[model samples]
Target: MAKKTKPIRPPADPLPPVIAPRVSAPPDPMSIDPEIQKMADDLSAKVHSPARDLELVDEFLDLYRRVFQQGNPIGLNEDITAVLTGRNARNGILFPPASPLIVKGQLVDRWGTPYWFHPNSSYQMEIRSAGPDKNLFTQDDVVKNPGPDNMGIGVGISQP
Candidate 1:
């Protein structure tokens, strides 16, 4: 006896191609004043120097202390502030500016998970991550120290 074959089903109505949203590129970091750019370059170059690193870190900490003392307020974004202050420092020939400097920090909790923070805002202002080497919310992993053998902390300071 021959077996009957099942009839083929017709294709569903063709769906329109799904298009992804376009992402705008981030603003250029070089658009800042040439003087400020020079200062940033100078600082970046000295970030590895032993004495200079200590001085920069101390300057960063001092600025944060003052900002905290003034009470936490909104509109304290660091990127723009850094550029403004960096310009002043460059013109004044100051290694670091007198304004509050924002620097990135990373600490591993007891569970071995890293917690990111910006030292300029507030000590309690932590940038949380998902868990276990997973930087779910952050744009990238916490920057590691670039010193020889990673002896010092990998820190970045904002100009403001």
Candidate 2:
């Protein structure tokens, strides 16, 4: 009779790799201004709301007014975003780079379209959101045409 060889057994299961939890850094204390902090809090409240488009614009106007005293960000949406998050910003970073509201360096609306900004004067600007349709200059667009002093006058959903 031939001698049977002992079969070798497989090694025990190895421990799974350890994955560290992701942790975001806290906002810088020195960079936090009182007014800007208040605005940040206010914006955070309405960031995900559907019926607060006008309010959101008002907050943005305040931020622009505070940062660029000469005028609002005078360019396309992304350019404006640069000023908002740049060195001259009072709050350091009103819109954090990793924020969902910011996409590709531009502040995007709920429909994922960069907001259209029309400067009327040194202290007034018309902010427009593409609205649910995601098309500019449409009836469904939400617009905030601030008065000569950035006052809310003809602020509502656009008509045709």
Candidate 3:
């Protein structure tokens, strides 16, 4: 029978101090990025439940395409939050009574990318997650619009 052996230990050396690359940092008391501050301000103003936001984005796109006859495409970037919340030029709340109001505003996705909402035109907007890559418009981007394929938005709908 083969005998088990204890692994030899290397000469004792002090362990290095733990350091990690922080993708995000706590807001400095005296300093803040304007873009991050914008996100914070938007969120603090009035956040909505993520589920509700999803429904709202989908519905808004559907209406613009189906009802308005504008054939608007959804390709949001970041400012779409203002459009949806009526903080933009539009005065009407397209989706009102923001449901399950838990978040103060557009919530950040898992990858730390804020839900970008950009209005391409009056009839079109795009909303998406930066995905794991944390970059917009990449192969990994989680698009809310789902483009022409609709990314299997519902049953019977299929993407190639």
Candidate 4:
């Protein structure tokens, strides 16, 4: 008797490949054009200086205390001490020239970049960004367009 022949098996199908989600790169402050980067670096250097840092902290604290006493909206540059300590204090404070508070008001940065300010505590007093220009006109200068670069400060006083 003749031996029976065996049948050949079929090949299996290949599995589908997995795909990953695409992620966009974050904007780099250092890569914002050579000129802008240089300006930013300079401003950063100034801010990091030990003497400047101390002075800024002192000024911020003073502003905080002033706002706490006045119980009114204060601008970024207004002499907070005078407002809080003097009876001539206005009910509402104006934004100082190129003040961070101005950016907070306009909802944009020195380069027209937008940002948000969410104070973690009521006692918190100020918000600011020393952009490339290091000027306060962004908050106070009446110019419709205060160039593309300027520094700013924001002062706030919350209810007790």
Best by TM-score: 2
Instruction: Report the candidate with higher lDDT, 2 versus 4.
Output: 2
Residue 141, model 2: lDDT of 71
- Per-residue lDDT of model 3, residues 110-154, tens digit only: 445676654445555555656667776665665543444433332
Worst 10 residues of 1 by lDDT: 142-151
User: Which digits, one per residue and each the tens of the lDDT, describe model 2 over residues 8-93?
Assistant: 99998999999999899888734646666565455546555544655665576677677556667678888777767654545456
Model 3 CA lDDT for position 29: 38
Off by over 4 Å in 2: 1-51, 87-91, 146-156
What is model 4's C-alpha RMSD? Answer: 18.4
Model 3, stretches more than 4 Å misplaced? 1-56, 63-78, 88-90, 95-112, 117-126, 144-160
Between candidates 1 and 4, the one scoring higher on lDDT is 1
Q: Which structure among the candidates has the greatest lDDT?
A: 2
lDDT of 4 at 61: 43
Worst 10 residues of 4 by lDDT: 142-151
Please, what is the TM-score per model? 0.24, 0.60, 0.34, 0.24
Model 2 weakest 10-residue run by lDDT: 146-155
Relative to the true structure, how large is the alpha-carbon lDDT of every model? Answer: 0.37, 0.65, 0.47, 0.35
Candidate 1 at 39: error in angstroms? 5.7
**Runs in model 4 lying further than 4 Å from the true structure:** 1-65, 70-89, 92-94, 97-104, 125-160
Error of 3 at 153 (Å): 23
Could you give me the TM-score of model 2 versus the true structure?
Answer: 0.60
Least well predicted 10-residue stretch by lDDT in candidate 3: 151-160
| Residue 59 displacement in candidate 4 (angstroms) | 5.4
